[model samples]
Structure formats: C-alpha cells, structure tokens
Target: MTAPQDHAPSDVPPAPRGGAGPVHSDTTQSAIRQSTSGMPTRPHGDDVHAAAGSATQPTGQADWSAFGPGGSGTAPPNTDEADRPAFEPDRGGTASADHALAEPQRVRRLKIALMVCGAAVTVGMGVAIAVLMEEASPPLRVGVASRPTGSHAPAAPPAIGGSSGASGAVPGNAGAGAAPANAIACPLPGGPAACPAMVAIPAGRYRMGSRRTDPDAQEEELGGAERAIAPFELSAHEITAGQWQLCVNQGACPPPAQPPQSSTMPVTGISWDAAAAYAAWLSQQTGQPYRLPTEAEWEYAARAGASTVFPWGNQLGQRHAHCGQCGTLPDYAGLAPVGSYPAQRGLYDMVGNAYEWVADCWTPSHAQPVPPAQSACHEKVQKGGAYDTLEADVRPVARTHGDRATPDVRVGFRIARQLQRTEQ
Candidate 1:
C-alpha cells in the first residue's frame, strides 16, 4: 500500500474505534475469531500414544461356538489314544474282509476330527493377524485428513512467520482461548475513542546486537548475544495522532508541540516521558498492562523474520520506508500517514517513519550492564530511523537516544501490551 496523496486531511478516515473490552482492529476481528474458532484443539502427544497403545490390544476373544457341540461354546472332550480307531492293511496293502467294515468307520471319524482341528487353527491365526495390523497403524488426528499409506506424519500447525533465528509459532496466538491482537475487535475504554490496532508477537529468541565484523555495526550494538523474548502484543502501526488525541482529550497525556495535519499520520514531537504517560493512561482505561517495547523487542519486530541488513533485504529498496534519501516517496521531508508502507511480521512502519522510543536507557556500549528502568534515568533509547535518517541509519541495528523528558519532531512511540494466560 502507498501513501494517499490525492485525499485531503479531512478525507482521510479516522482510526477504528472499539467497544469496552480487549481492543483489536475492526478488519481482523471476524477473521481471527473464525480462524481460532475453526481451529481444532491439538491432541497432546501423550494422549496420542495412549490411544495407539489401546488400539493394538486385543479387544475381545473370537467366537469359536460353531465348532463346539450343540453351540455350547466349548469343544467336546478329547478321546483317549487307545479309543481312537486305527486301520490295518493285509499283505496286498488292502484291508481284509474281516476288518473292512471297521476300517471305513475309523477313517471317516479321523477325517472329521482333522477338519475340525484345522478350522480352529485357521480362526486363531486370523485373530492374531487382525491384532497385529491394528498395532502398526498410527493414531488418527482430528481436523487433519488422513494420509495415504507410507506418507509422512500428520502435518504440524501452520507456522506463523516472525523474526529470524527462531521458528514461527502460531501467528497472533496469545494463549489458549485468547485471540491474536489484530483479530479481536473490542471497544476502547472510557469512551468511543479510537484505539491503536495491535499485532500479536510470538515468543522467540534471537541475537540482540550487531557483530563487530560488520562495517555498519555501531560500537553500542557490538558484543551482541542471543536473547530470549516473551510473547506480547504491539501496535500494528506507529501510534497515530488521532489515538494520542483521545488520551489528550481525557487529560491523561500532554499535548503534542505540533499537531499532525492528518489524524492518520504517526504522532511525533512527543517526549519519551509523554509516551510512557500515554501507555499508563491506556493501561488504566483498558485494564490491560501497556508499555513501550524493549530495545531487543523493537529490533526483533523490525527484522520480521529477516536476517538481512534491512527487513526487505540487504539493500534499502524503493518505497519500502519513508526516510531521507531512501527514495520512492512523494515527500521525504515529512512523515507519511500510519500504514503508508507494507508490514513486516504484521507490523507496519517499523524501520523508517519516526524513531520509536523503547523502554531502555542509553548505555555507552553493549559491554556495560543495562541500567534498570526504576533507577534514575538520563537518556532513553530510540529505534527505527526517522524521516531525516539516511539509508544506512534506517536499519534494525541502528539506535539513537535523547533525554527522556525532551520532545523532538523526529521521535514518536508505539505501545506494547502483555499477553495474559488462562487455565485450559
């Protein structure tokens, strides 16, 4: 999607408004609900194993009643060896006249007995084979179509793509029974004011900083190491002026130095402190914890499953972002409206819009311990280069910092909310 140039500021639609509940985008609510609703509950591995075991065992004994006399379900008592009749042949290999009558009767009885015994053996073998076939079969899965013989195991849940260095889990999955942030539409708290659309970011681990070997790597971003992040929800787009205005209307946030011409434009000229205040105000209204994303989180989301220098690729492609000298924009001097560009990992304007405030202090280098947020703060971290940023500066690893209380036209912030879990 490209920025709207023909439409006037008034022609641009206001941001979506939600009713009193968990907030999400209006477009995605039905889809998310449908997806989650239709999604079959995954069977536990242990449960599947248990089912397989039960299927293999013999269900019951085979009926052999037909072989029993009078259908009594029991075989007749065995005859003693001495009582069994034996045939005798004369010198010519033929039965003599005196034993001819007895021989015929004995032979008939012997053949009948043998036939009954053979039938019993055959029935027993059939039962054994049936049990074996059941044991070899795999447990059936619900909502998944059965594969042809010799096919691979049932397919896994579709992978929801996310940041690099970690496999994607279900997209926008918060927990059991919880919908993804973008999919669930709810009302904004306190009034009918519009709320920022949120995207659910799955939990994953990745390298947090740049390596020393890289030419564009910053000293502050070196000595990077793998870091684990928890599941959380972030605004799909940079917080728009219309959303901030709602907070200001409630007297919960400070006014911007210069109001945006269009409500859809990302709100700038707001201090880090003001951003934090807006987060707190949102938490109070929605009864959900809201705050700024951590520095590591910002990088991970910006990368959006890409390991390249830029989320799109190693090079800064045209119209991918709004940055100075980045090219492909009608106006590089000013910020475009929110969602003016494509999304990464379902997040929009992560790299080139306004430099976003993160919830971390500006340490000199990666070697030093990160200062705690509770402690006295000096300069806070900002990420995702701004409109005036060069191509090299508009990377996931790029960072800038300023006094927490000071506001700049090049800076703005997004909101992140915690994912709550419920008992299954």
Candidate 2:
C-alpha cells in the first residue's frame, strides 16, 4: 500500500479559472450546521446485565395462563414456594376452642388465612422486580475481532495509519468557531492581482522548528535568530492571485486581481494590508470564520513534518529548490507562480523564489543576543528565503519586515481559513 503521508512540493503553474467559477462572494454567509436528528442509541448495558441476573435467580418469566381464564372448579393445590417471599403469623383469638368449631366455621377460617398469605406474596414479588430495574448497566469492553482460522492477508486496523493500537477518538468537537490578524510584507515572483486559487488546509496542529546539523546550524548560516518556536498551521499552498481579487471586490482594498494568474499560481503584488483584509472577508462569508496562521504555525507547515531547515531535508539540493541553483542564483527576478519547485521544502518555492508573508506583526521572538535598545515588535519575520542573495537568505528562521502597505516584486502571500465547527 502507498504510504499515507508524503509532502513533495508541486511544480505546477497557475490554472485557468475556466473549470469552477470563483468561490461565492460572501464567505460569512456560509453556514456551519449541526444535525437535528434524534440521537442514536445502542442496547443499554443494564438490559443485558438484568437478563443475566434473572437467569441466575430461580425467578421465571411472568406467565398468568396456568390459573385458567376464570377460576376453574378443579384446581391444583398452590405450591409452598409461591409464598416464599412473604411471612406472616396470625394472632391467637381470646375465645379459642370455647366450643367445637362448626364444620363450615372451621373451613372458613382456613380459607381466609390462605387468601391473606397469597396476597402478601404477590406484593413482595412486585417490589423485588422494581428493585432489579434500578441497577446501572454493565461496563463496555472492546475485544479483538474474530479472525478466520486460516487467512491470507491480515486485516487493517481502524485507527489512523493503524499505528496506535487503541481505537482513536470518534472525530468531533463542540464549538461555534474562529479569527484575528497582522500586516506582513513578502516579495512576490510576479506582480499583484494574478494570484491563483488556493488549496484549503483542513485545520490541524503541525510540528515546526529544526534540529542542529542543518545548514542553518552551521557557523556561516546562523545569521539572524536563535529561539524555540511553537507549532502552528499553514495554508497547503501559497495564496493565489484570484483570492486577493475577492477582497478587492468587497471594496476593502484598492487594487483588483491582476492578469498573470491562471488561477493556480501563488498570489503576489499584495501588501500586508490586502492579505489581512482578505482573511476578514473570508470569515464573514462562511457565517463562521477564518484567519492567518500564527508565525509558529506557518513554519510548522513549512517544515512539512521534517526537523530540517527545509521540508525536504538539511543539505540543499539544486533540483529540489529554486534558490541559488547550480553555479547561478535562481531568484529569477520575480514571483514565478506558487509550487514552482517540488524538491525545495516539500512545498513549492519555499526555499527561494518569493518571500512569503506571515501573521506576526514585524518583531523578533529571540533574535539571539536580543535587540538591545528595542522591543521585538515593529518588525515582522518572513520565511522561504527569497532569491537575489547568497544561500543564507533561505534559512528557516530568517527575519525581515517592510511597509505593510507597499507591495514588493520579490514578495507574495498565501491565505488560510480555519474550520467553523467540529462534531461533539
């Protein structure tokens, strides 16, 4: 079977919008619905437990037919056990044996006693039944599936990748759901207005940061920062040109979607403000929500499950990345559509090509010796080192920040929207 996970960047260029027209204009109106159907149920554990309990005891299923439809002239004597549940003794009378009881009088006394005892036994049985009903159900336990005595291929387990032996949790969550912001600037491979349609990254946590021994860990490459970064989410691909158009169409940003994007290329030419506006617009349309990933999330996704500087691994491979390739530097002078390189960071163009914007406002978390006279705020960090420089420009922790309002030729962005609600 093919492995369930593999993160190789796509080299495909922008696509034409001819297939599906743009997504709906208002994303906020998109509703997140929960089912209104009745809750599903399985047989209660107590029911089984009660059945087993009754089996152990001598009590039988209730049957009333043996007495006949009406009292029969001929009847069998009552069994002693019928009165086993009740015990009562009659009080001695003050005028006992004063005279030999008459034949009818003696018989009448005996019949009255039996009648009283039968009534008491019936009531006791009813109370016992009620008590049995009140006990809690039995506990549930999962057991191994029954396998045929002799089989060829083994059965696959239900959990994800079947890695963990335990049954994973039934998928669901309770929540109304999700938003927030920042102005980030990135250099695009192309001008703004032509970014392509972006892929939806289902909301999930991913690991980020890198291990030592990476090129960035070397003396020459570790130039900007040193600190531990938390995990976060990122868009599957870079922001597309058409997505930016949605924000402009809403009248939030001045520039409209431009010409170059065929619908699949990464978005470019947008300043940080434009990207932030698109995020807000998307949230409102879903009637639910959306937001850019935190800086931690962005890097986590970029790492693509790897602890290396790039998603592919530590040593840079020319064919895998687009930056400073061969004897020549491949910055290429402009944004070249998203996914322009597959071997780069397990995601397209991550190493070089275009510096992508992140959600954090310009600032440094642990920029080494720490900025002496200033706060970490006021300067943003960028990832996927860009072209137009030595190889150092592409280290994972590389940092830089520029005007949020102005677009840069070498910078671009991708958009991210969070899920509205999960199951309970």
Using lDDT as the measure, the top candidate is 1
lDDT for every model? Answer: 0.54, 0.36
Each candidate's TM vs. the true structure? 0.57, 0.43
Can you write out model 1's per-residue Cα lDDT over 159-205, one digit (the tens) per residue? Answer: 22222222233232111111236434345643432666677776767
Worst 10 residues of 2 by lDDT: 14-23
Best by TM-score: 1
Cα displacement (angstroms), candidate 1, residue 221, comes to: 1.2
Checking candidate 1 for backbone clashes, the offending pairs are 18-187, 18-188, 19-187, 20-187, 163-305
* Residue 20, candidate 2: C-alpha displacement in angstroms: 37
Q: lDDT of model 1 at residue 184?
A: 42
RMSD of 2: 26.1
